[model samples]
Target: MNTKDMRDLDDAELADHIKTVRRDLFGLRFQHATGELENTAGLKTGKRDLARALTIAHERGIDTNK
Candidate 1:
């Protein structure tokens, strides 16, 4: 998802998106460690996406730690 699409999400939805992205990033790391991941670049992309979401959440003053 792009920044524009992420900005369109409400607070709750954005939090959920952050969680999902984090989970996906974790899974990618696991796959890479197991040597089963073909597209290793996904790790980089996932990190950037997570960072974007977190940045947006921070800007909105949303506490995503919950």
Candidate 2:
């Protein structure tokens, strides 16, 4: 997801989107550990995306529940 897209989201949507990205990252990590993941670059991408979401959440002062 691009920052432009994230910019369009309301605070609630931003929080939800962060949660979704984090979930995807968790799954990706699991797949990587099992040696079942293709596109290893996705792990990096997922981390970056999760970071983007987190930055947005922080900037918006959204209460991210850990």
Candidate 3:
């Protein structure tokens, strides 16, 4: 998802998306460990997307530290 799309999500939705992305990241890591990952670049993209979502959430004062 792009920044604009990420920005459109409300705090609760953003949190849900974060959880989903983390699950995906874990699966990706497992695939990589098993040497089944076909696209290594996807791992980087997922991480960056998660970071972007978290950054946007922080900028909106979501108080993620709670």
Candidate 4:
């Protein structure tokens, strides 16, 4: 998703998206470690998406710890 999409989400939605993406990132890491992941670049993409969600959350003053 892009900045415009991120900005469209409310705080609660952003938080949920962050959580879901983080879970996907974890799964991707596990798959990569086990040599089951074909697309290794998924890790990088996951990290970037997570970071983007987090940056937007923080900048919007949304509590990420939730």
lDDT of each: 0.97, 0.89, 0.89, 0.92
Highest TM-score: which candidate? 1
Q: Rank the candidates by TM-score, best first.
A: 1, 4, 2, 3
Clashing pairs in 2: none
Instruction: Score candidate 2 by TM-score against the native.
Output: 0.92
Give the Cα error of residue 21 in candidate 3, in Å: 0.6
Angstrom error of the Cα, residue 61, model 4: value is 1.1
Give me the runs in candidate 3 sitting further than 4 Å from their true place. 63-66
How many backbone clashes does every candidate have?
A: 0, 0, 0, 0
Residues 19-59, model 2: lDDT tens digits: 89889999999999999999899999999988888888888
Clashing pairs for model 4 are none
- Compute the lDDT of residue 47 as modeled in candidate 2: 93
* TM-scores of all candidate predictions against the true structure: 0.96, 0.92, 0.88, 0.94
Give the per-residue lDDT digits (tens) of candidate 4, residues 1-66: 887899899999999999999889999999988989999988998899889999999999998886
> Which residue segments of model 1 deviate by more than 4 Å?
none
Candidate 4 has a TM-score of 0.94
What are the per-residue Cα lDDT tens digits for candidate 3 across 1-66?
999998988899988888888889999999999999999999999999889988998888885543
* Candidate 1 per-residue lDDT over residues 1-66, each given as its tens digit: 999999999999999999999999999999999999999999999999999999999999999898
Lowest lDDT 10-residue stretch of candidate 2:
57-66
Q: Which ten residues in a row have the lowest lDDT in candidate 1?
A: 57-66
Candidate 4, poorest ten consecutive residues by summed lDDT: 57-66
Candidate 3 lDDT score at position 31: 100
